[model samples]
Target: MLQGEEASFFVLCDGKTALPLGTAQDHKRVGEGDTGPNTGGMGAYSPAPVLSEAVQERAMERIVRPTLREMSRRGMPFQGVLYAGLMIENGEPRLIEYNVRFGDPEAQVLMMRLGGQVLDLIQAAAEGRLDEVSVAWADDHALTVVLAARGYPGRVETGVPIRGTEGLPRSSVQMLFHAGTALQDGTLVAAGGRVLNATARGTTLQEARDRAYALVDAIDAPGLFCRRDIGWRALGPVQDAPATSQPT
Candidate 1:
């Protein structure tokens, strides 16, 4: 198993200039306590603690910028979201993988924390005008919990009836994003392994985590499971916190 925190950045590169839109961390395991086989992503939270301001600077200076420069040098000229899966050891950041696009649940949390003209930024990058675009990020924490069908990352049972989805918070700070779902006979049903994303934002990471999990618990879907400890590593050890969601 790969034991490292992920540092994801929404980069706006225009062949020469590479601008970062935001950073986030994704929980990729299928079980709590970080056990079980790897799924696409079980949950995610924005502004990972592992990627501090200094660490982000190092990543850009040593990793992202150079990569963009080399790509341009080779006439590739990449644009769009550049996700860097990183491994940090002894306070040093190392590259693990470079995803050309945004990771699944990672996009859910990042969109909640980012402000300004998002579409404009993306267009600017794609049009090679990234140097003219600036990003405005909110001083808030966001989290997302993925509700997966039974036997997910394996043989998932789909088409099951899902309930309690009619009434969930739908503000700029809290909402749900549908993933693998469909309507059958005019009824919403689970259509894939990862069905829904319960997402929320707050002033603190714990607040966001709590709000996201609350939504997860509210969904009365049978044969569906989600990791309760979505932001456990970022929240650290809480005194007598709910034991149902122990860190993996």
Candidate 2:
């Protein structure tokens, strides 16, 4: 097992050029100890401290650039968000895998931290004009907690009504993104395993985690649960170590 951080980078690639959009850490395990089966993502946080400035540079220089170059050389010319899942082993970033677009919970946190720059950057990349775009990230942290239905990552029980979604604290820092949700005759209910994402931004990782968890607490749903330790490692020492799982 790679006993390291689940660091990921969203790099906007436009054939001839590539630019990093942001970074995040996603929790994929279904259980608190990171034990149990892997799901899409139980929770996630942005600006993972494990992915230090030095590691970010190494990832771009060794992994992202080479991958893009190889893709272009093969005539594929990959464009869009090339999300690199990296494992920082012995202070050296190592490759894990790549996603074609923004990750679920990771996207929630990154978008929270980056604010409106996300859309502009994506549009620029799609138009192949990344050179003209620049990202302005707030020096803050964002966290997201996924509310999942019972038996998630397996045979989930759906159609459970969800409550407390109304009047969420909407502002520049807090928001909710709907995923596995639907309205049945004007009733909001869980449509899939992972139902809703509660995201919040704060000056520190702990504050962000606290805010996200508070949102999760406010939400009332049958068979809904989430990990309390979303960014435990990033905050400080791991009081409860969760098992590692694959990224969505």
State the lDDT of candidate 1 residue by residue for 16-68, as single tens digits: 77887777888777877678889899999998888887887888888888888
Question: Candidate 1: misplaced stretches above 4 Å?
Answer: 1-4, 237-248
Whole-model lDDT, candidate 1?
Answer: 0.81
Give the Å error, residue 126, model 1.
2.2
Clash count per candidate: 3, 4
Least well predicted 10-residue stretch by lDDT in candidate 2: 239-248
Per-residue lDDT over 81-131 for candidate 2, one digit per residue giving the tens place of the 0 to 100 score: 888998887779888888898898898998888877777888888899999
Residue-pair clash count for candidate 1: 3
TM-score of 1: 0.91
TM-score, prediction 2: 0.91
